[model samples]
Target chain A: MSRKLSYREAMREAMHEALANDPRVFLMGEDVGRYGGTYAFSKGFLDEFGPERIRDTPLSELGFVGAAIGAALGGMRPIVEVMTVNFSLLALDQIVNTAAALRHMSGGQFSVPLVIRMATGAGRQLAAQHSHSLEGWYAHIPGIKVLAPATIEDARGMLAPALADPDPVVIFEHAGLFNIEGDLPDDWSADIRSARVRRQGKDVAIITHGGSLPKALAAAQTLAEQGIEAEVLDLRVLRPLDSESIAAAVAKCRRVVVVDEGWRSGSLAAEVMARIMESAFYELDAPVVRVCSEEVPIPYAKHLEDAALPQPEKIVAAVKEMMG
Target chain B: MTDHHAAAPPSGPVPWDKAFALRLLTDMLRIRRMEEKSAELYGAGKIRGFLHLYIGEEATAVGALHALAPDDNIVATYREHGHALVRGMEMGSIMAEMYGKHEGCARGHGGSMHLFDARTRLYGGNAIVGGGLPLAVGLALASKMQHEQRITACFFGDGAVAEGAFHESLNLAALWKLPVLFCCENNLYGMGTALERSESQTDLCAKAASYNMPALRADGMDIVAVHEASKQALRTLRESAGPVFVEYQTYRFRAHSMFDAELYRQKAEIEEWKTRGPIHTFTARLKAEGKLTEEEFLAIDAAANEEVAAAVAFAEAGTWEPVDDLLKDVMTPPPPAPRPGGGDAGSPPAAAPCEG
Candidate 1:
């Protein structure tokens, strides 16, 4: 039997593998060292990698991320971790302005080979401040590549390629999916580009990424029994949008439903739908629908939070509505 | 401490030899002439965007940069035309960048505010208030991890002391014992806001020392002081495990930019600072010591003018980048495609562009 690993363990394994393989690759972030990471991702890494390799940073996201970019320029492959996507706003200027613009601004003289990993999405009753689906905002940027690793394979495989990439790459690890365990084949490597068809169907396409991917899968299963075959397309790479795969899914299914944790207003789902409209409009059987979190700030209560997020039932409803 | 501003006129015999003295003098002159022409170009609409001139602040860059090796990394602020020139960046590329030309450094994508060159290790001409501090920390971290003896010199205005990045970077660098030279160019103002008005505690050295860092203050107007202070910091960085902070007490002669109407300060104050102008006083001391004659000074000035003219002509001839190639280099040429059907699904291609 293939060994099963949780999404969090897959990420930790990938980081550990990168560190053990490449001397240049070091992990730096708040609480990543002695504290064992805010989410316990870097547990026992400090002793293995030592204090130098496993750096614990102060609550200075802007400083550390910028330093990570500089280190990348100075010829070290750095993997920077921000506690969550909500706190990443503090370092957005460095990510967008410095990391993204450095290579082109330097006229190809420099490339920031830096990887930034941050937990994202709303679940576990973390409330508004701790949880936010800001991956959509990051995906809007052009210079940096954005990744949403939903599956255990993706969580395990994406880090190596991201660290291997010359340009700055931001990986969004949905907080909700961290504990979800799945089977991982021995060879668990993947590319940082293109969407993957987790479940193939011709009747409808359930397009989504990150925390919403599981919900999308469950919804697909529900739609399968109802005689509506829905293809579950995981948008692995969000920035470039894996337009080819998105178009392929839309063309095959002819009906589309975008499930995202972000709100409907100008979300990544909106951008995906717009691309589908532009490229696969003629093939569409019905208007593309979106099942997104409510526009209000996510409340702490479980029922309110669940009601606000994209549930499996919600994805099923959106897919059914799109098919109709 | 009365602002020494070229105190006591060089004592007796000249300190630096003729060749070395002339090189330092010529560097300041080059910055002065380039920026003077840049101001004219700005008026002619040849160079747009914010042009922060380093007219009087030449000594700080000229002296400090000369103290470091060619391979050392430099992270500077927007008013960095002088730093770029002193670090051996071509004047033509700097001028061409201001012109937004394809042949320019950074290929004209970043205007006056953003100047970068990978070959020279000039990290950037960072414009954000305290943006370069964190970058310098990172560069030093890389050098430390690789066991390389290179130092990362970060230059920023006193305005940066107010930023959280400055505090965090200082703490990080100090705690980690990374090799970094924190060059604080205390030019008295942060785009119209004076130091005392903005900062609660204006003593920069004390702030750096609070982080358990060894700090010093240098006369930013005096080339010798700036150079010596930088060398001291460099030695500390090379020998010691921690970072050093040096506050360059300097002033700017021109308005912050072409847009300023000189609203904040008085003309007399500007004139008083001009009395302490780095170029003329250093030239005066050189003349008194006979290391520089009137003819030699004029010749140096004339040479600077000629270089500025040549740079302007070069910028005039530079071309614009085609809009089609705009997307190139955003990512590292997307690594060459994985070969046929042989490689493992999880394995990366051999042509990985990172860690080079």
Candidate 2:
């Protein structure tokens, strides 16, 4: 049994389920209430959950995020929605310093069972200030879990396990995927741990996550038409980088291409390629290559923004180059 | 702005009965003695890192903490030895934490600036200037949502008033009508930057007033005034179910940290503030009111010394956490089986995502 839903609807369903099932759960963020969330993911949530549970916060990221951390400590499951990953920098101190370090700093005495959701990646012409893919920066932290839900099923299912986890979890919902519609299986629950192979092939492995997953999948389709078959490995969980799955994919395909929306230097693609070298160095037929965003502030013009991001054409070209 | 030089010595009666009064005094003395011992230990290389002494600010923590119920939560700043002590954290554990020992309150992970005790409902010994405010607001938010009858007390220095977190947290608490007692221990300097130099509006009460909350100022040097003001603030906070802000005007006698060279202020100013020293003035008032005898004062001082000595002994005996267990608490261990929708473990694979 399956249903069709957009990524926005899927995420809304996940949040609604969480709020309905847990009395301790609440959602607070800028425009989460009457404005219905910046992405319209929580449109009717305010009416359903009421004011106390569906809190509309002022543009105080540090305050609300820290308050969410405190609420989690006080035994409430709080999901804070920062409008975009670009603005999350305002609350970075609370998220990185306090929420991530609390349990360890408190000597295992406290764990922040908090989930922070933010829009990431760029497809629209939202300029430098609004468009950022800093999930890799968060993935670098030790005490928190970083997840990028790229598929409709993942958008619907990942929230449950993230809220259930005892530590802080950051879910980056690709801004481009919210409007994309897909089939949602009746069984939509997903693990917040492993990487899933989206498409199976033997010639080359295309490793990516979040907004780039669909591009990788589309590129694989394009590659298959030309005599080269590419495997699409969606890294659902970014932080504890499902190294096992990555290594398996690398070992199976021997040649690899990593796709990341972040800039080339110190990118998640960089980390994935390094992990492949560490775990499956001997299995490589060629050196791993990556298709990453150009090292410039994402531009406002449509063409420039597209140029700054990884596209299906770029992914296919990278795969073909690796296959050769 | 408060004129520290012109302020009169804290006088007048302590209304509480002998036992309660003595307990408050003992709490203050405990902080003073413990910190003094900690200073000596720091010199001996026993306690490393930044050692911020709460020597003169003891009255604020002791008096304000007494106004709170045992179940109420506490969030304090880096100069929080007094707050932690007054909130009932074990002196031994506090010293052990400063010593970086396994038996410390935070098991040596958090040092003096981050003494967290779950047993006492003390949220943290936060080092960031305005960091604790939002956490306190959240704690109150949780309590209000859960229908719990407890308020959270947050302590920060005057310097924190200038941070964005301070303004944002105050607005949030007031907007939500959360039950939190915003205790601002206005101890003249924030690491040698005087409050007047940092803040555009030095009147912290005005800052709170701008948030539309009832703001009060207390003589932080006077334990009685601090207690009375805090009691009034907490009372209003509980009755109204809204936040209240109290600015405890105080001073820090010691340098900002062990590394500071005491270059910012004049020695005459320190001497002037010393006359209004919380312990001496309060003891003098107790003598004038015939509430305390000289022998009783000596005994109390002796007892505090003994306690400090015992805490030092405990910290000395406390062991270092093994290097093998360094990565123990970075994350909570995952459950045996993955939690499904809404955290029900065995909810069947019906909700599991289908393989694409």
Q: Scored by CA lDDT, what does every candidate get? A: 0.88, 0.89
Q: Candidate 2 lDDT, tens digit per residue, B65-119?
A: 9988999999998898888888888899999999999999989999999988888
Best by lDDT: 2
DockQ of all models, two decimals each: 0.56, 0.50
Q: Give candidate 1's TM-score.
A: 0.96
i-RMS, every candidate? Answer: 3.2, 8.2
Q: Which residue segments of model 2 deviate by more than 4 Å? A: B1-11, B339-356
> Tens-digit lDDT track for model 2 on A1-324?
888999999899889988988888899999999999998989999999999999999999999999999898887889999999999999998988899998889888878889999999888999999889999999999999999999988988889888878889999999999899999877666888899999999999999999999899889898899978888999999989999999999889999999999999999999998888888999999999999999999999999999999999998887777666
RMSD of 1: 2.6
**Least lDDT summed over 10 consecutive residues: which range in candidate 2 chain B?**
B347-356
TM-score of chain A of 1: 0.98
Which ranges in model 1 have alpha carbons more than 4 Å from their true place? B1-14, B340-356
lDDT of 1 by residue, A1-324 (tens): 369999989999989998898888899999999999988999999999998899999899998998998888787888999998889999988898899988887788778889999999998898999889998899988789999999998888888878777788999988999899999887555887779999999998889999999999899889889998889999999988899999999889888899999989999999999998889899988988999999989899999999999999988877776666
lDDT of 1 by residue, B145-245 (tens): 88998899999999999999999899989998999999999999999999899988888888998888888888888888788778777776666778989
